[model samples]
Target: MSGKSSWPELVGVMATAAATQIGHDRPDVAVEVLPPGAPLTPDYNDHRVRVFINLSAVVIQTPVIG
Candidate 1:
């Protein structure tokens, strides 16, 4: 990922990956994940600015398999 990328883009990437994983097991299932909030300080590195966005995206995109 590039530094100029937006938070939403990062989130979308994660979502896509999660969706792919879900599709692997349940091809008929559809996943719709959403971000909770901005990324926290610990979620991103010091060189990143939109860490909150990325973090939030990751949280939202994470799959909950049971």
Candidate 2:
């Protein structure tokens, strides 16, 4: 959990793989796979990483710890 805080390379990866990779890197945080434009609270969390995906279940944005 002391490595990268963001995964820009995972943008085009599959959601499941992205989640698994993120989880392995930051087991202390929660990884949430969500579709783009999904409703999300404005509050930022240090223990959370949101993986935004497209309709094909492919990550559309860089997964980052907020």
Candidate 3:
């Protein structure tokens, strides 16, 4: 009996967990301010941010064969 949730819920949970971990690990990372009317670029988005984190040794892993 697996206690798995839906995809969106799982994503939310994982994001929350990562944020908690980051906060615990490094509390000095400041939130950057974006200028108003800034173009919505994928390069400046959360997914890109996550990718950067992963590449920079922030290690985000997902379960395999779940």
Candidate 4:
């Protein structure tokens, strides 16, 4: 929510996950149900489920000697 925090583009994430599961041909309907910080419950579409995966990771980098 904070500008300083690099919160990922949530809507896009959901949309993409939706598309991945259901295929790109599916309409962009899931986004309407997906409000900011809304819970992607089991009842929700498969696409929404995939989007949740984006948060299932942690990115780390090793320090460079430069």
Candidate that scores best on lDDT:
2
lDDT over C-alpha atoms for residue 16 of model 4: 44
For each candidate in turn, the TM-score is 0.37, 0.92, 0.29, 0.20
Off by over 4 Å in 1: 1-13, 37-56, 60-62
Give the distance in Å from residue 47's predicted Cα in candidate 2 to where it truly belongs.
0.0
lDDT by residue (1-66, candidate 1, tens digit) is 222222333334555564555455454443444445533334433332322214435533323322
- The lDDT values for all models are 0.39, 0.91, 0.31, 0.31
Query: Model 2 over residues 1-66: C-alpha lDDT tens digits?
Result: 477799999999999999999998889999989986789999999999999999999999889998
What's the lDDT for candidate 2?
A: 0.91
Supply candidate 3's per-residue lDDT for 16: 47
TM-score computed on alpha carbons, candidate 1: 0.37
- Tell me the tens digit of each residue's lDDT in model 3 across 1-66: 223111222232334454544444434432221233434444432221231123233323431111
Clash count list over all predictions: 1, 1, 0, 1
Model 2 residue 20 distance off true place after TM-score fit, in angstroms: 0.1
Local error of candidate 1 at residue 32 (angstroms): 0.8
RMSD of 1: 11.8
Q: Model 4: per-residue lDDT, tens digit, 1-66?
A: 111112233334444443343333333323222333546444534332232333432212211111
TM-score for candidate 4, please give it. Answer: 0.20
Q: Candidate 3: list runs displaced more than 4 Å.
A: 1-13, 31-66
Off by over 4 Å in 2: none
Q: Return whichever of 2 and 3 wins on lDDT.
A: 2
Error of 3 at 29 (Å): 0.8
